[model samples]
Target: MAKRAPGLGAVQETMLITLHARARCGDEAAARLVEAIDYDFAPMQRNAGATELFHVLRCAALDEWTRQFLAECPHGTVVELGAGLSTRADRLDNGTAHWCYVDLPDATELRRALLPDGERRRTITGSVLEDGWADAVAADPGPYLFLAEGVLVYLEPAGVRRALTTVATRFPGCRVALDTHGEWIVKRSRGPLTRMAADLVWACEDPKALQDWDLGLTLRESWPLSRPDWVVRRALPRHTRLTLAAVNAFVPRRMTNSRVNLYSVDATG
Candidate 1:
């Protein structure tokens, strides 16, 4: 008898890539999940070290923002859009906060098998382009923090706008944390991503441009991945710190073009 690879699309399969990266970064739970899965992760090893560092820094920044939100609103609801094998809830559970992991049916099925729903946390099977998941999240408490992470770049510009607008319209006054790639990165990513059957369609030159959508979103903070805030910077290993410093000094645009952004949803909208 043999185990089977989970039936997931190319973009969904990328979750395993991030899972492997987290495992490489010494995430015990991610490591265990990697061993449990039967897929060939060889392709994911192309740039393993860089992938691990990139994911570590990205997750660290998002985790920091999540921690800050939880600190201010202990019982607020935290919704992770397109959450695929993400161990965020496990990492940032404040005991009282509600957690909702939303994703497509295939991804959600895999996640449900590994990460079971609990009293404080649960999973919803749906697309971010739709509004059904919003209703489920609305049932939870207020002061929501929606995390899109590495999810939106897969969608077209219109789809991205629709998704963000939906969040703003439904969960006003909420906060959203997401990442965006510049056209240069997106163009370069196409070739490699095509091999995995996934593509990066949405390219944002400036995260602040999102405010022009009239979705009631205000860009609260945006920073390049290579230069995270002091909290995230302090947690990095010495090697990673030095590497990022060098990258920041020489090829600044390489990392600066892609950023992690935090936006606040206005209540009036």
Candidate 2:
């Protein structure tokens, strides 16, 4: 096992939950990292069934979106905000695109120790609320794709607006892919097995509300967890697919309102 590093904050530690899920789903890189880490994954492992499936499905949707962006802009830059032990760069490298992973200092420290950085791949240590990191990302090629995956929900509403506004202003015409929790989901996410110590703070009932914020964002697509796009649905196991179908048929929409959203940054922002 690798040497244990200093403890991560409550929110940062949650990355291990997604990491564990990816490992359980047969990701060789994730599995290797899981074996190398010294932390006790027992708590995260206990919630493995549906939670793991949902996590992977969400990742699949984002991967497909990223692939689409790379197809159009092969030399474009991809920046993952609040990236935590994410194997996305490894999984989606197209040889020519630049990849930058940004997160808190300690999380970046741990990630750098475990993941290799190359001429095209690098890590930036900073929070999304800061402006310094944007300059480094802007220095890369154009037509950027910024992914905030499972990061922003922990922030207060004001922070979310500020972060998105910064991205809109700095990288106009770029694409941003992020996940949001509805008010209902945010309320329930505080359950014992769900979020542990990091409670979700922002609650967006509809992604359209983001457009109303005057942040120069135009929602292109939003996929609810219960109803992922065909690409993500077909890739799921039969049992998982059946379960999602049942949820779509029976579960209240409010309960499953969390979504993966894609937005286009207005060029005139």
Residue-by-residue lDDT tens digits, candidate 2, 156-205: 99999889988999999999999987898887763223746788889998
Give one digit per residue, the lDDT tens place, for model 1 in 55-170.
67788888999999999999999899999999988788989999999999999999988888999898998898888888888889989999997899899999999899899999
Least well predicted 10-residue stretch by lDDT in candidate 2:
188-197
**Which residue pairs show collisions in model 2?**
none
What's the true lDDT of residue 174 in model 1? 96
Candidate 2, residue 153: lDDT:
89
The number of clashing residue pairs in each candidate reads 0, 0
